[model samples]
Target: MISWLMLAQAAALGIAGLVVAIAGLARRPFGDLALFAAIGAFATLVVQIVASIIAPIAGAGPTGDLLEYWTYLLSAILIPPAAVLWALVDKKGQWSTLIVGVGILACAVMVYRMHQIWFVQIA
Candidate 1:
């Protein structure tokens, strides 16, 4: 069965990314939006961490570490805030735009990977 928690995290990140992009376009203050993304990612991270801790018990180790499998969770947890921080620290428009693009790309890859995980059924 597909894991609902894992899917939930992906959905939340996708939504958060959309919200962040909209916030970017609207030219609004990003503090609250950043906080929302952080909280969503943090909550998702907690689920992933818990899953990692229980993986051996869940018998996924013959496959791989749950942590290793959850690259999306890791990216979701780190990338947005990192992009915002880069936005704050960088003086160059080129670098700031590049970082934002990278962050968006990471999230896009995450969405694709998530669809792979959820869309395929191992019958």
Candidate 2:
């Protein structure tokens, strides 16, 4: 995994998470802005997934347990959409929005963990 790309992905998700969180705090419903932010975060993870596959082929593979790295990556990829879907389904006003915000934040943390598994931990 590339250091710059990992950092970029984490930062993007962090920003998205923050945006949604602020919206939720303001008592806003799960609206376009929150949806867009979540989708943007999801898109970043999708890019990371592509990078994960191509980076290894380009000889920039993880230094740690490949399985662990992939597990984190795959799980991180699922979070945003699931949160969005849940938010849409629950429809409990700001709480649902807040849940999405929290879920996105969790994804950001997972991305950081993935970076650690790829670059910090040793096999």
Best by lDDT: 2
| lDDT at 54, model 1 | 79
User: What residue pairs clash in candidate 1, if any at all?
Assistant: none
Cα lDDT of model 2 by residue, 1-65, tens digit: 68888877788788889888878888888888878888888888888889899988999888888
TM-score per candidate, in order?
0.60, 0.93
Q: Native-vs-model 2 lDDT?
A: 0.85
Query: Would you list the clashing residue pairs of candidate 2?
Result: none
The lDDT of model 1 is 0.55
Give candidate 2 regions above 4 Å deviation.
none
RMSD of 2: 1.2
Each model's backbone clash number: 0, 0
The lDDT of each candidate is: 0.55, 0.85
* lDDT (10s digit) by residue, model 1, range 9-98: 666666666666666655554455555565555565666656655755766432333343466556655775677677667633434434
Position 82, candidate 2: lDDT: 93
